[model samples]
Target: MIYWSANSTNSNQQSLSGSNPKKKVHSGNANNELEWRDLEDYPLNLSQQEVMIEEGKAGSSWGKSEINSGYNSLLSRTLQVKGSKVNCFFDTEAPKILVVDDHAASRMTAAALLAMEGYEVIEADSGAAAVVLVTQKHPDLILLDVMMPGMDGFEVCHLLKQDEHTRLIPVIFITALNDRRSRIRGIEVGADDFLTKPFDRVELAARVKSLVRQKRLNEDLDHAEQVLFSIARAIESRDPNTGDHCERLVTLGQNFGEYLNLSRSQLRDLMWGGYLHDIGKVGIPDAVLLKNEQLTLEDWEMMQQHVLIGEKICQPLRSMRGVIPIIRHHHERWNGSGYPDGLKSNEIPFLAQVFQLIDIYDALTSERPYKRAFSPAEALSVMWEETQAGWRNPELMQRFTDFIHTYNLK
Candidate 1:
């Protein structure tokens, strides 16, 4: 039948549907299906939603008993679809989806439906709780109720999208209202999809499956980028002079981005840029690469080519698109003085700007064999001199210095 179910006896068995309610429909008993009346006329809309959400309403009597039986179309009549192809994103790990609804009865119903569809369901009763849960638990998907009391689904989605930690999580708004304005509002607030009240059980299950699959694919992409970064960092470590350069610069670039209040995507790109900015140096010859002395003009040009090399190396990786700018443009000065392209002022990528400043700062403060390291304050002063000499952005440097002092970053 159309019911999605997994046998409870086999925990290792991965199935698209949960076994309990789905089992009732598929157990071949026919008695459970017989017990379920046709719900074709059930008005799945806002009033029914208010009844479930608000106490002392006309349809408040709708309970879990009704929800469990609401959608069990015959398998023979179910819509046929091709099975998903297994790829890097397809894995045995079951995705966790957070279901947020102010009404417990309604929430339990949705959770049961999703759980039957082979997803691990995490439940939250309110919008505020969902926000906190999203920050701490980082669920792969959120099915949020639009009718919460204090912070509604739209507000919760907005808040989560605004935070770097939770921004990547996909949001699907579940609402009783099917109006054009409500749908538009949900979209404006960053919702990926919408599930109207009294939704078709099959449609609901399909939507959940689609989003969870997409999220898993995204996770695999993230994993790929992580692997690429590891390889790049390993290459960087070949030079004895690196000494925590990538990690420390990542911290500083992230801090500066935070101080500037950049968006989550901007901040995340900076972090990636920090790790892979020197990735192309892996291609440079050691003679010029490890040299501590001032570079001759030829050596300098060869060294600068590392930027172009780094960009080319990462160009093929679809997942590393965000990181390429930092890798290639981190050396570009504000006044068109730095290599490799000498992109001036705002022409430089914003993320590259943040990374470049910290890249220089970290080098200045880190102790080297030929020269003593500058203290944090001294490092800032030296960097300020670069700003004055048109080697860096004067305004951005001023803000970064302010952030350093305000946060007491040493």
Candidate 2:
């Protein structure tokens, strides 16, 4: 039995559909005309939702292989706000939630509660159906029932968590079983929270709201990283020497970070930092960047300014604050000798240090104007020489080298 007490407080009681519809267009170019989509004015009623579901089901059968990319295009929009980082508006569209349970009553009750608060809700009656819905609907949060006929909640969660695209969507297990073993299993499978069956309405709303807010923050942060990477990649495209160097750094760096059992935050920073470390180069002149011979002192000085330029370029975006150190400090030396700032050794940001190693490895392996590409063995030997001169962290170098060789990172 689930309790469904309505919110009685008179202070600002409005259902999601009844809320203000006139939203500032979160998308479109500022240089042209701004466009606004009033969500409240065009709310989807039950009948409309049924029609969309039926249409989606019919479309699904035609392209079963494309289910991996199935996204509820109806619920999500590409939010592109234009302006200087300062003059822009930041708004998050409402969170899309998927409620998965065998009981129709539970799904209806939960959906009504979530909708009243402001979240858009979708329903899935079985684990298999929920898995399919996840890829297609792309819900921000999932409330899953523990016991079902074939695929249990634990199995469903494991499968979702295994997929990178769906993993970030938080899963809260709803179960009648309150045993220690069941709880342990949920944690093992990466369930974010647990709701013991026979639910409390207030608790449900609170948990859903809290999780959705956190997920939104993470999504925003990820979007920021992607923008930074894309800008850098565009600049890299101008130079023939760099192809997918920035992207490769992210992939290789993430692998090395994981092999070392680095925390999730550290790995995220490594990926973002690897792509962004050279963003300062976007400002460097082509003469200095593309010169075949060694750089003159003047050209070297101008090149060095890239790090500072990158730091200033990213300063306006609050979402990129975590990566600032990485952009600024990656060129710093192990022995207080390298770039923009003279600070060395422990003065280097830890995350920057992690990415610096990845950046160097990628560069060494890549073909450049003045240098031939080095094989993996040759690259390791060169890095060893740097360690001998105290130019790099000996311990981190050793671990990174071992990981690459062990995994055959090519």
Residue-pair clashes per candidate = 6, 1
Q: How does each model score on TM-score?
A: 0.59, 0.67
Model 1 clash count equals: 6
Q: What alpha-carbon RMSD in Å does predicted model 1 have with respect to the real structure?
A: 9.7
Collision pairs in model 2: 70-136
**Candidate 2: tens digits of C-alpha lDDT, residues 1-410:** 12212232211111222234233322122111212233333332332122111123232221233322333311221122222121222255556778888766666556645554556567767788788778877998999988876788999999999998888899999877556777889999999999875566678877987787788788877787668778888788878878888779889988988998989878887787877887889889888888878889999999999999999888878767778899998888899889878777888887788788888888999997778999989999998999889889888899888988987945
User: What lDDT tens digits, residue by residue, belong to model 1 across residues 1-410?
Assistant: 12233343211111112222222222223222111222223222212243222333232212223432422210101111112121224466556678888766567567545544445566777777677667665788898888788888889999988886677788888876556777889899889999887656677766877887887777777777777789778877887776888888778778888889989888888888888888888778999988888999999889999889889888977867888988888888889988888799999988788888888888988988876888989999999888998988888898888887886745
Q: Which ten residues in a row have the lowest lDDT in candidate 2?
A: 5-14
The numbered model that scores best in TM-score is 2
* Global lDDT scores for all candidate models: 0.69, 0.70
